[model samples]
Each structure stands twice: as structure tokens, then as C-alpha cells.
Target chain A: MLSRVLYVDIGKRSSWVVDKHDIFSKYLGGSGVASKLLLEEARPGIDPFSPEAPIIFSPGYLVGVFPCMVKAVAMFKSPLTKNLGESHAGGHFSSALRFAGYGALVVRGASEYPVAVKIKDDKVRVEMADSLWGLSPLDVERSLRESHYEGMQSVISCGKAGERLVCYSNVIVDRYHHFGRLGLGAVFGSKRLKAISILGTGEIPLESPLAVKEMYEKLNHEVVLSGKMSKYHDLGTSANMLELNELGALPTHNFKDSRFKGAEGISGEVMAESLLRRKISCPGCPIACIHLAGLRTDFAPEHEKGKKEVFSEEVLLPYNYEPMYALGSNLLLSEAKNLLRLIYHCEFLGLDAMMVGNILAWTTEAFEEGRITLDDTLIKPEWGSVEAYLQIINNIVDMKSPFYAKLAQGLLETSKRYGGREYAMIAGNNGMAGYITGYGSIVGALVGARHSHLSNSGYSIDQKTMNQPLSHEQISDFLIEQEDWLYALYSLGACYFCRGVYTKEAVCEALKTVGTEKTKEELMKMGKEIFHNLYKFKVREGFELAEQEPPKRVYQVQTPHGMLKAEEVKAIIKLYIKKREGEGLRLKPEEKALKELLR
Target chain B: MKKALRFHIDVLHPERCIGCYSCVYACSRHLFNTIDPSRVAVFVRLNGTIANPFSVIACRFCKSPECAFACPTKALQPLPEGGITLIASRCEGCKTFDCISACAIEALALDRRTKLPIICDRCGDCAKYCPHNIFRYEEMK
Candidate 1:
């Protein structure tokens, strides 16, 4: 069946539908399909906040029916990185949307005034949202529920941060889950689009009912039997804090050291014991790995005073491993209660918590080194002080102070303005994540994505290749293969949690059900083609991987194993450049052969 | 007495449902021949906000049978045991969403390939799919 694409022009107050059968067949939906749309619609050198910038929401093929890990991809031109930007989030929203029958929604042109779009099973309507324009995501969701009391509907909207056009503003889906990177929310705000509400009742078709039944039974049994799946099912992503801390790979004091002494305070075990309330899963997921943490506000009084009052005196914040490490240990925050408060603030404010933590860490290091005075900056970093962190978060979202305005622009921009590229923890203009696991292959992956760890999670490299380090050339080649594979998974619209289950064979089987006649080998080749295409896009946009360099502090910092040298990291970069060249060469030959044959 | 065909199905209490697809998977275990819940007959949709929770959306087993009344080819028909049923052989692959529009509770869906209407036949298979007891099957009073 051909997937239908819905197009909305908020500026002209127009709505239309297109059945892009060719695009869906080739891209196979989700991010792959959305990227094709983005490349076609978004012009080079156009301001990300302009009407020309497109906001796209595309669901993976398995969304409405697949068990667990149905993520909706929100793609836009990023104001923060000023490059191709996409963020994936899982919630009830995407599945509901898919159930509603459209494969994707492309929103173009700004609304002349603030408005909201409501879609209810073949019925699409746009309503005035001037009253909701400046409302936080939480409020907008509440108002939507009160006004539109249709059968289970999900909403994706922005907060004050997006309305203010904060460079790192994220679009919040279902209040908690977010298209949480690259300022996609700001693009929505620029378009004066307040929210998108979808309630779908249409059903997707299954090819063979008997085959689907057998597949589910076998897959369910495998999931239950797998030890790896067990760990994730128990702790979710929060399982990494203690493990990374033990490896001395935890980013602490803003990357000054690889380990945090207070890691125990916020470890997964600690969170499980103190804060974990219940396990929540997205869409059709059976693992139910997400642990929604219950906050205990009264437990820590010292951390609760002053500017941190916005958080419920008794609150429950979702605790994940990376945010804890980034906003907690990385910022020298020791109290779990306080760390929870900081995380909550970031979510409510619609800021990318990882980038916010990275920028704050840089500011702290600069402050300690006397690069900036207290008068020059608004936030003061005291180890484990949640109140201080809250103050800083407010400043950034509001852009109330000069320091925060620059900080809100993100690490790369801040560093460039303040002369601190040596300490800035960013790659491809995006802030680095919390996984410090391997021989910096993860870092290389981050660089490759124009700065997204998920683009090529190097954690596996750190896990398997830790004992025997690879040469720079080998590392680069390995990363290219990993990156291509990861891109394929993303393109397939498959969740990373099922990376183990969706093996090459599984992927091929899934594709066969979708009517694609390609073998696993052919699918992989297509993935390679997509990877090279992304690289070409980056190059066309003036990214020089050969000249790309990691922050100096990465090399200087001492891990539990030892310190890495600049030359060692440079060799890795050289290897990456060579691999890229090889991929480029293969593409050229394929194109030439096709041309010659045609002639 | 006419022999009543027992079609396995489940009943959902929306208040008890957390919007999770556990039951959806349990139903997919029987229906789609794959783990993909999208193909399953039983699925959950949100009736409200995250704070308000979700509304259970599936076959409601209406007595008046709007879907059967709306079926152009009698593909959807009333069962002797009560509720509606789908006759695969009688279906003519019509894309007409008459049954879908006629469904007040929005339960009926057309199969992707055959374009035949699908209806809940109350066989009580999905009752086991719900771990939280949101779905239950009992002899009508």
C-alpha cells in the first residue's frame, strides 16, 4: 500500500495531500523518507527560522503495529548547528499518527498568526492559537486536552523557549518526550505553529495474519530469553551511569576529568532504589525500559532553596543515565534530589539537557580559570548545587543576560565568541554526549553526524575494542562501516533498542513484509549509498572532516586507563578522511559505469 | 438451532488501560503472523493527555450494527450470537469506507490488500492479551 503524505502551509492557511509512492518505496519511510523531503524543500543558505525552512514529522514503517520502539522523526534546518538537523522521539503520538493513516506530515511556510493544527482520521482543521502562542508545552497540552476531548489524541508542541527562538529549543511531544535537539521547536515557533494534535482510528494492513502471529510469538520468546534485553528492561538507559563511572569515562567537572567522585549518588542502582516509580514503554514495546523516577523534594533542603522553587517541592522526574551524568557529575552536582530538579527545569524550559550541560560545564571551567568574572556570567557552579544550576537554566531560556545569550547559542558559537575552542566539548558544532567508553571512536562518530551520538554510537567500539586498540586507519574504516549500518537502521525507522533483534536477516524479513524485493546485501548497499550521500551533503555545506579536530581537553584529560595524545587523535581523523575518500571513489565508479552502459 | 460461529475477541475498559500495547502484542500473537502491532485487531489510542491517560479503541460490539447496515455487499453481517462479523468470500475489494463511517465507535478497518472490511466477532482471544485486566470476556447476563 502506498503511504500518504500530508502537506500543510500555515502561512497560506492551506492543506493538501500527496501520495509519494516512489519516495516511500526507495527511502522505506521514517528518517530516510523525511530526509529526502527536507533536501528537496529546504534550500542551502536559507535562515533556519525563515518560512522556507520545513518542519517534517515522519513515522517509521513499523510504528503503529511494531512492539516497542516506534519513533517519530522531526526534521528541520537547525538554527544551533546551521546544518541538516533531525531528532527522533518515541511516544503514543507517532503510533496514533500512523493509525490515522498518513505516513508523514510536511509543514511549510509560516502562519500569518499563531495557530494549531488538529487532525482526526481524515479530518484536518487549523485553529487560531494566539492564546497558546507563549504558553509552555505543559500548558499547551493541558489546554488541548480540555478543548479537544476526542478519543486518545497525542500532541507535539513547543514551550516559551521555542517561542523566544532559543537556538537549542526542542519540540516537546507528550510533555516529556521531545524532538529534543537542533532547535526544531524554534522553527515551529517561527511558523507561529503552536501544536499538532493527531487522533487516528484507521488501521494498517498486515500481509499474512498467520505469519505475523508466528513472528510475534518467536520474537517475544527471544526478547524474554536475551540477557542483554533483560538489563535494558530493568534499568533502561540509566544503566550506563555506574558502568561508565567505573570505567572513568564519565564526563565530570565539564570534561576536566573522566570520572566523578559523586557518581554513586546518581547511579542506576541508586536511582532504582530511591527514585524509580514505574516502567513505561513507547508504542508497542514489550521491554518497558523507561523508568519514570519519583522525586523526593523534601529529602534535600540545602539544594531546594532559592531559584529552584519552580520544581514541585515533591516531584517525580524521569531519570536517565546521560542527563544525570551531564547535568549532575559533569556540573559537579552531587545531590540526586538537586540533579532531578535541574533535569526537570531543562525539560519544562524545552532545552536540550545535554547541550545545556555541555555549555554550563564550559562556562564553569572558564570561570575557574578566571576567563570570566561573576559579573560577566549569571551562573556560578558549586559542586552538587541544584539551585545554582536552576538559575543558569532560567537565564539561558530567557536569554536575559549576555553570557546566557551566547551560551544559548550553543558551545561552538560560545567558544568562537569567547576564544575557548580548546575547551569547548563539541563536534560538528553539536555538544558531545556522556558516553566516554572507548578509544574515542564514539567521539569520532559524534563528529561524523555533524554531532549526534546516535548517528554512530561508538559505545560498542569502546566495549569490544578496549583491550586491543585499533590503528587510526583501522578505527576510521571500522567507524565508516558502523556509521553506514547505523544509518541503515535509522533509515529503516528501527529503534536502537532492537538493534540486536533487527539483525541483517531480521531487517530483510521486515522489508519483505513491506513489499521491498531487496536482499539483505542489497539493502546494506543502499545504506552505504545513503551514508555517502549524507557525507556529500556535509561536504557541500563546507564540512572538512580532514581538518576537523576534537577539543584539546579530550586529549589532555586522563582516563582510568591513561591520557590520550593529540597526535593519536589526529591519526584517527586522518584514517576517517581516507575511508571517506574510498567511499567517495566507489560512488564515482558506480556512477561512471552506469553512464558508460547507458551510452 | 443455528450453529453460532465463535469469533475470538476482547472487551476493553478504557479507564483501566494505561495506553500500553501489551494486549495489542498479545492479539498480534494470533492475528498478523508477525509481532508488528499495527497489523493487530486490538490496539490502544489516546483519548486525552498523558496526564489524563489513554482511551481503549477497538471493536465495541455495537448491537444496532451500523457497520453491517452500511456494508454495500453484505461483507459485514450480523452474527446469530450478537455483534458483527466479516465474510471474506463475499468481499469485493471495495475501497468504500462505508463501514468505517458507519461505525459510531470507529472500530471497523479495511484490510490493506483485499480491501475487505474487518469487524470484531467476539471470539474472546484478546482477553488473555491484557495483563492488567482492562479486557475481559464474560457470558452476557
Candidate 2:
């Protein structure tokens, strides 16, 4: 019944909580609510790094209560696209913020000095963090742990890449989880906000405790007892290695080939058999899908311990298919340890692993093509060269070199500068997500709101397309409908992993427990409304529909089906723009208006 | 002399612990019908780093319970089988917070919002809900 929005003005070092009931109740939560806030608070022409531009973190409506509903969104105008920046992460962030008595947290205004904000229950403290400044998320965690950030606390911090204003820098949470795209970290750095620590002790009020318990048990049964959730439970999403490899849709060496020869080396089964040490989960998640891997390295023994004694030391890090694919197959780095080190470097520096992988892929191709030389990249980025990638990873965060400064802007901009725009393989200034699976994915990337694969769920459509091919109209219909459903689920704060659990019937039933009774039709309506609202925000922020173009590299690449035809890719993207513009009665007026303004 | 039976949360294989905090949620919901993991019977503190480390804070239910002895109001009564049975109604809030400081592992923490000490009820809900069997249920004679 109670939802509070905590607004912090860093320049003034002041904060306040406002009960924005109408906004929250309508939008529900997560990115939907945050998008509305961005519309209200963000000035249209202000720079993303300016004092007036705000960074908003909103927990989902069912965040503290619902099972598998874990992600919290950090929203802002993107420096990368200069349009919309919305990134999400899973950990204890949502639950912590909700239990701390706030539904949303907005950080506005740039601070004069480094600062870390602490939120414990109702009290918010803005403290100087000079000692903790300029450190990686991992190093900052050490300082935070020694202070009051122990025992049931979640921290969101930026690292060196962010401090250097890398366009694709991430806001890292709990080291492994991140709001991992589109320059939110730069916004944090520009504000001089180092980190946020939350300690929540209050219990969330449940409408019907018994009903909620019943739904949870059912969801748990679906998650644990069924084979549907087992892949995630066992090897995690990296199981896609063999499947995607067999699909011939594995993007290898900068989209040159859709298949990698060394696919088995970094496959989920091998990772589980060798490096997997633990399976961690976010709050209320029964699946425990996040696999923590152990990276073993030999180090010099102490003189007292003995000379010539080498011991293997294990450093544990968590990974999913996206990171593994981006850092492993795409870069042609087969060794597990090398992939782990590269990924850890990205994690430590607070760079989006997906974006980093894309840029690295492009950089390697550029080097091979002789467009950029060793002097520009500081290394000969040969295929399968982990050593070169390691050196370049350091340069990415440092951003001191001329080439590295261009790299910070992201693959699209950098490729344009270095003569590889055709092979850049990006959508809306964002990198591809380790999947060149099919036309659905490629088209979805181009046509998605804010150019995110997850936005339209084209990955699922890609799978569906493999079994049964669809017409351009059918694909467009699928994308629009899935987008609607996903928007609703995200608003409800339900994780997509539990898509099996939160079916239309299941979600409606679950809502009954939370004192909200709605037919599935009404839910779909809300989703459609959210879809329009997001487009409105993006359009007003100067996102031209024509700019969402399919790169030439996508057509050149091979997919599971065969060679993807240029006409097919172009037709799908064209139909997408058409349906979105001229169809759908509810949004036709706005779409017409947008068409007039843009055309 | 009769051999005594005891139960312990065998976290000897702490590496196996997924850091899920499922036990925490299970305990809190089963006990108070709430979702705050902090109010739960067990709390898992993840190092929150890319490099691994984590600690699950829970009462050991020791052979000799110091928290029980530290309570001036006799609010905490030691069970013969091990662990303490807390009588929440009988408790007058401890000024010294001796029960909290008495525990070697600091399993018992004070909820400053309510100014009340929180102690584990030795409810095995955590053991039941843990997906990985990280919390081994042990009965030793």
C-alpha cells in the first residue's frame, strides 16, 4: 500500500522521499516506471553527463515479495546512443531497496567530490569516499566490507572504465551482476557518485500470506521438479554452446563465421565439470541459475614455503552464456582461464562484457584487414591471441591512447572511425549479444526499443523460426506481442527465467495473492500502453526509426539455416518499421505523428 | 553415562553453498510471514566480489549455549538437546546486549528499529529449502 520514491540531489547533498503512488501504481515498476520518471525528470536537450540529467534506479512492483522477480533497472539518457539508457541487473538490489522503504531511487546533480550514498532503512547518508575513489568494483567492495557494508548489504559501484567515461561502462552490483549497457556508469562517474550501499531490515507486507505461499510453492515445483529449469540449474545458460554450435549460429571472430571450432572447450558441460565452484541466486530465486566459476592460476611460492614451488590458486567468478560467448567464441579465445581473466578484467573495470566483446571482435578484424595496425591498438590482435586481448583490455579502461579514446565510444562509432562499419555488427550504437542465431534475432536487434535483444525477445523467436519459418508479417506480429508480454512481466518484476512460471494464467493468479485482481487481457492492455510510452520517450529523445538499420555484416554471416540473405534481413526490418508505424489502431495516431516528424 | 544426541548445520563444505539465501527467506516467511531475509533465522553474507568468498551466519546451537546464560531475564532457556528456546514475551530488552555479544559467531543480532534481539529458533526450514544440500542436516550421538 505504501511506495516511496527517494530523490537525491548530489550537488546540494540533499535527499527526500516522495510518495509517487499514481506513477508507480500505473506503471507497476522496473523499467516501465523508470522510463516514466526519465520522461518527467530528464531535460530533453541536457547532456547525459550534465548535472541536470538524472540516474534513476527503480525496483519492480513485486520485487521484495515475488519469487524469481529480481532485476532492478538503472535508467538514464545514454551517452553511447544519446537516446535512452536503461540497464537491468539481478542480485539483492531490488529486495534491499524495497525493504529499505523505497520503491524508486533517483540520483540527480553532479557532486563536487567523490561520494558514496548509504541507505539503511529510512535514513539516507551521503558520505565522502575519497579513499574508495578510482578503484574497481572488486577493490571498492573490500573498503566497503571493512566499513559498515557487512551483513545483508548490497552495493552498486562503478569502476575505472566508468571513471574514464567509457560509453558502455556498467553499474556493477555484487561484482557479478550489472546494469550492463549504455553509459549509466559514466552518468554515475560524472555525478561523482562512487557507490551506493543499502541495508534493509523491514519486512514487506503481504496481502494474503497463505495465498502467496501457495503460489510460491507451485512456482518452486515448476522450477525444481521439471526438466525445463534443469539446464539453467545444471550448466546454466552456457549449455547453449553445443546447441548454438549445432545450430551453426555461434558468432565467431567478429561475425566472419557463425560457428566456432573450439566451441566444446568453453561449453557449459566442460565449465561445470572443470571450473564451476558454486551456483548463486538472487533473492527469492529457487533456480540459483548464476554459476560461479573458479579460475586457477599458478603463482610463485614464498621463499619460506620453498624455492621452485608453484601452487594453483583459484579465483572464483560468475558467468553466463553472454559473457562466455562474447569473451570466448567471438574473440576466438578458447582457453577457459584466458576467458575468465578477460571477463574479470571487464568486471573489475565496470565495462559491459557484451559491448567489450563486440568492440574487441571489431578491433581484431580491423587489425587483420590492415586498416588499423599494431601501433593503433598497442597489440597485433590476431585470432586466438589471449595475450594481445589482455593488453588491449588494460588500454580499454585506461583510455590514454588515441585509439583507446575512440574505442570508449562503442563499436558503431569506433568502427565508423576505423573503417569497419559494415562489420561493426551493432544496433543503435549497442553491440550484439553473442547470438547471430537467425533473422528474428538480427531483425529484433534492429527494431527493438533502445536496440536491446531482450526488449523484443527475438532470441526466442529465432528458436521458433528454426522449427517453423514465419512470414515477415508473422515475425513482426510475434515481436510486437512478445514485447507487450515482456513489458508486463518486467513491470510485475518477474524474471524471464520464470517465464515458464509466470504464464498469463499464473500471473493473474499470482496477482490475486498480492491484492491485485486482473484478467490477462487487462495485463496485455497495460503492456501495450507501456510499449507506446517507451516509444514515445525514445522518439521524443530523437531516435529516428530509419537509423535502426541492419549492417552489411549480418547478411555476410552464416546462420544455422544457411547463409542469411540480405533481402530477407532487410524485408524483416522493413516490415517491422512498417507495422510499428502504420498499424495497431491504439498507437496509429502517435505513430503517424512520429512518421510526420521524422520523415 | 548416556550418549547425547545433537543436530548441527554442517557447512563444512561451504564451497558447495550457492549463497542463495533460500534458508533465510524460508525461515523468515515460515516464522513471521515476511520477506525480509535480515529478519530470518539464518543470513548468508556474500563477499560480493568477482573473486569468491562468503559466510553464512547462523547459530551453531553449541553444546554450551552462552547466549542463554547471558540473558538476565531468563528469556533464553537452553534446551537439553542443544540450542536455546527464546521466550520473546518474557524478554525485557537487554541494555548491555549481552546475548548478542555472548555468541562467539555473532549469530544473534539486534534489530535496532525495534530494539529487539533476534535469535535463531533452530527451525530447519533453511535446510529444507536449500536447493544444493549445502546445509547438511546432521544428527550425532
Candidate 3:
């Protein structure tokens, strides 16, 4: 059951499960497994929007059997960033897929009209979703959830944002969490697939059920008692606002400055006190990182009292450090409620808030510089003005004008068209995450297989150099090692939030239950092999590492450490390639450039 | 002085349940030697959005025990303290499941595989593994 990959061809409206024993066994799972599948199916130079390019969903190997290992990764050729595409969602996505008796779900081909794929255990059906196509993710979810599959069901859906093919559009898992970045939703839109509904009633067999149960109990108990996740469980990830602000690492006003003066206004402490309604946990996760923030409308006392339901709304928004920094502080919107309202719009529309934030930041700066006008955007961009931003967002989603259409394509492409390329702030064509800490963040993205900040925990590495004495070359070495190790865990279905708990030994222990036995050393080797495979796919897809250059804004912004250093980042990227070369890391034509640098 | 006590499963806080299904797995692992929540007695029902609180359902083990009395074959028996006990051999699954109706809370239902009533013996497995501690066990009341 755990060794099969489900393939769905929307053109034919047919689905089948194939045994991919070696794929899951060798790569483990998640993006690691997806990369190998993509290599086989997705031809180089194929249009990313073409039906031939597969949209893959691979749940981690440890998913459905372990706690906090809930992330299900989406792998595709990104429509937003234009290279290796990957996004992750938390909720019951992985569990649902596992329960539906598949290790991965590979979706290919385009439908003539909108449709939703339903997997009820062994049965698979593709139903027309013409009515559901243009609906909001929230509305679409409600409709499909009522459509009744067997047993417990979960829907992976995209909203109007995806239907409209917004490049940074997201695939929302359930209502709150998302495969939030790199435009996987846009790929779904291209395929004319609205959603994938799964009803799983299958059980994963454990080699030693009793020992597995004991292990699960031990990890479960430690989750609550240990202070390791106290921050996440208590105030949610938004608590990082004040902490990053104090460190002068929080992105403010499109990274003109790293710290926001009104940081306290939107801090996690304030949100938890003023607007937090509840803390929601992802499936199988004890540490509930998602915060449900309440938005109350101002009305007459009598009206407010009589119409409580209409006046008050609770939106399940993960007020994590990334979104808070990107949508809140980065754009200089200081109030928590305003940020909540804006995030609710993004989440409801299925837009990637971080990418959207970067786009807004670049747009605002361009407008301020007089490069864009009211005629261009239909509004005068202003800092911290939620009203103005709201109008722009509508325009972007509607894409009525050429300006708004370009904006929908993400910051990089929009900047090229609008004459703000210098301030675009994108790396590897993908929008940057919230933090602008230092060289670590910039370099991590440039070298990242997916060009994600967490790809190697670059900002974390930057903070490391502050305390520990490590040279630039050593820093690059460390980052490379971490990326390799993290990819191993990511493939194994371990969440970055709980990676500390699912140590190599712990993963081996968990794997042994499901009939895979490997020592810690063997696991480490597997990690590096998977890391190389992802790079191989990227290189094949025309991602040239040596041709990569930092977005001009990376140098202009004042980081926590000080002004950014282009040469230092360049040196680090060079050192990184050298380290990879030492390990026989192969690239395509990009290998020539990197080799020349080595000489 | 220490004394052995009969355990009773109670949903102490239904509103706070996050529907992680940890309790279901725990209960199943103990009773069936497998990790199948459908086999577990306790149920966590999720509807609407995740914004809404999860509802955990289980037999409250009523004081009167109507399920015990409604049984035509005397298949349902009253426990010494609370809750109803099911005698597997004497039970009949066909021609209208009367005990499932007798349980007012809709907590007692036929297991999908076995087609027998999923009666909570109140073994305390569900409460022990509830991630949020939504369930509790105490002396038979």
C-alpha cells in the first residue's frame, strides 16, 4: 500500500496506481521521491503549463505513522519562479493520501473543462467541476466536503486565484494551510483541475506494532512537556515579530529597513491578547502553530449586539513569522487586525501571501519613485494603508488591465515590465520569504534547489556566525551539509518545525516499523544522494547555478548585520559549488561555468 | 490508601478537540493490536471548517443504561458501575440494530468491518493518548 504511486491523467479523466517500489525505498518520500518521478515524466524545455509536465504530490514516508510528520509536498515546474517547483501543506493531506493507499499522486494532462478528482480508497472518479471552478477556496471546500466521499475525507483545492492563473497562487489544503508557494495552484489551474478529494480508511502496517506504539507515546508526551516548541504552541510563530525586530532582522517597507518601528503593534503578544480566537493544530501535530485571529467590525453598539455573527468573523490564519514579516512588517502594515484581514483575503483567494507581499513591496516602492502612476495601478500606493492595498489586490486578481495582469505573475516579471527591476527582491525568480537577515538568506535562496530560504536555514546559519567563529567558506560548507541533511528528513516526511525531534536515529527507528531498516550513517548517505538528485532535475530543467545573480535589492537594503555584501555572497556561492564538486555534484551546462570558477 | 478504580471515559472538553486522531490510534493499538481508528470506540467528528472546534464522541455510559434494557436477546448488559456491556455471541446485527438506537448520543454504532456495536469498555486508552487531554478518566460514577 505504501509502495504505489497514483497517476491521474485529467485529459482522459482516468487514474491508476502503479507500484514504484524502488522509488519510495531509495528516495524515502516527499519532494525527494517526487524529483525522481518528475525526471522520468517531465521532459526538459516542455512548457511548464503544458499537460506533459506533471504536478506531483508526495507525502513523506513517515507520514500516517508518525506525529508531526504531516507535510505533503507538491512538486512541479513552478509557474511563479520558473524552475524547480515545490510547496508543502500541513493538515490531513499526507494522512488522506496514505489512507487512500498511495505513496504519491502524480497528476498529468489537461482537462477540456474544470474537474475535481475524487479517490475513495480503491475507487477513483473525475467529476466535472464547472460550477466550482471560479469559486473561492472556502466556498469550493464547503461544496466538495458536502459531496460526500467514503469515511474521513480531505480536499486539496485552489481558489479563484488559481482559476485566474495568478503565478504565485497557492493550493490550499483544507481551509487554513496551503501548498502556499511556487505556483502549484497555477499549475492546477493550467490543468483545469480544481481539487483532489481523498477518502482514506486504510491502515499502515508496522513491523513491530507494540514498539512503534511505545515510540509514538514517548514522542507525543515529550511534545507537550518540552520547552522546544513552547513558542509555537503558546503564542504561535508570530511571536518572532518582536524578537526579529529587536535583532533588526524583520523586513520593513520592502526592506528599506530591516526593523519596523511599530513592530510592537503587530507582535504575537498583541495578536494573542487582542485578536486570537483559537490555536489550531495540523493533523498528527501536538504543537499547534496555526492561530485563528478574529476580525471585529466597528458598528453601533445596538447593531453590533444584535448582529454578532455578521459583525464578527474568525479567520484561521497561521500568523507565522514568515507571513507576519512578509505581509505585515515588510509592507509596513503595523496593526495585527489589518494584517489578519489582508492575510484572510490572501488565504481565501489562495494567493501566496509571501510572494504577494514581495510584489506589493516592489510595487509600492516603484510608485513612490514615480515609476508607476495611478493610471497604472488604479490607486496611489501607500505604506501601511490596508485600503489602498486591498484595491490593488482586487485588481491583481481580476487582472482587468495589463498592469494588474503583470502583477499577478509575481514581482520579478512585473518589475521587468514596470521599470522597478532594481527593487524586485526575487532570488532564483521566486519571491523571498519574510526575513532579510543577512548574506545567509540571500545565498541560501540562490543555491537552494527550490530557491527557498528554509532550503538550508540560511538566516539560522547567519546567526550562527555571530556567536561561533566560522569563515565564509566554512559557513558555505555548513549550509550545504544542513541542506543535504534536511532534504533527507523532508523526503522522510519530517516537518522542519519538528526536525529536532525526528533525529536520524529516530527516523531509522520509525522506518524499521514499516519494514525499512537503515542505520544513521546509511540515512545520512541517502540524504546527500536525494539532495544531488533534486539538483540534477533543476540543472536538467535549465537552472544554471553560475548564471544566478542576486536581485539588486539584496544590496540596497540594510540587514541586521549591516549593508549586504555582494562579493561575500558570491564567494559563499563559489565555495558552495566547490564543496558540491568535491562530492561529484553534477550539473548540466552550468557545470562548465562552476568548473571554470574552481580553476 | 490505594484502591483499584473502574475507569469511565468522558469528553471533558469537546470544544477544544483539534481532531488529531491520536486518541483513536491509541485505543485501536491497545484493543486490536492494529492502528485503525474505525475499530476504536471513541470517535472524533470534524465538520465545517477547521475553524470550528472538533467534536469527540463516545458512550457517556448513562446512569439508566437504556441500551442494556432495549436489547431483545439480552445481548446488552449493564456494567457494575456505568456504561453498557455487549455480549458478542448473543448479539444479532440484522433486522434493525436496536442498541445503536437506544444509545441517545449516537456514540454507539456498528463497526464498519465487524458490523457489531463499538461499545466502550472504558479501558482509559482514549483519554491517555488524547493530544489536547480533551478526554478524562475517573472512578466509575
Best by lDDT: 3
Q: How accurately is candidate 1 docked according to DockQ? A: 0.21
Docking model 2 quality class: acceptable
Cα-based lDDT at residue A429, candidate 2: 83
Question: Lowest lDDT 10-mer window, candidate 3 chain B?
Answer: B1-10
lDDT of 2 by residue, B78-131 (tens): 877777777877776568878878887768777655656775655567887777
Better of 1 and 2 by DockQ: 2
Top candidate, metric TM-score: 3
RMSD each, Å: 6.6, 3.4, 2.9
Error of 3 at A47 (Å): 1.3
Model 2 C-alpha lDDT per residue in residues A239-318, reported as the tens digit of each score: 98878888888888888888889988988888889888877788777687888888876666674376433566776778
A440: Cα error in model 3, Å: 2.0
Docking class of 1: incorrect
DockQ of each: 0.21, 0.44, 0.47
Instruction: List, residue by residue over B34-73, the lDDT tens digit for candidate 1.
Output: 4444455565654445654555667766666888898888
Model 1, A77-105: lDDT tens per residue? 88887876778887767776777778889
Q: Give the lDDT of residue A75 in candidate 1.
A: 77
- lDDT, model 3: 0.79
Candidate 2 stretches greater than 4 Å from native: A146-151, A301-309, A582-599, B1-14, B47-52, B57-64, B109-123, B136-141
lDDT, residue A167, candidate 3: 91
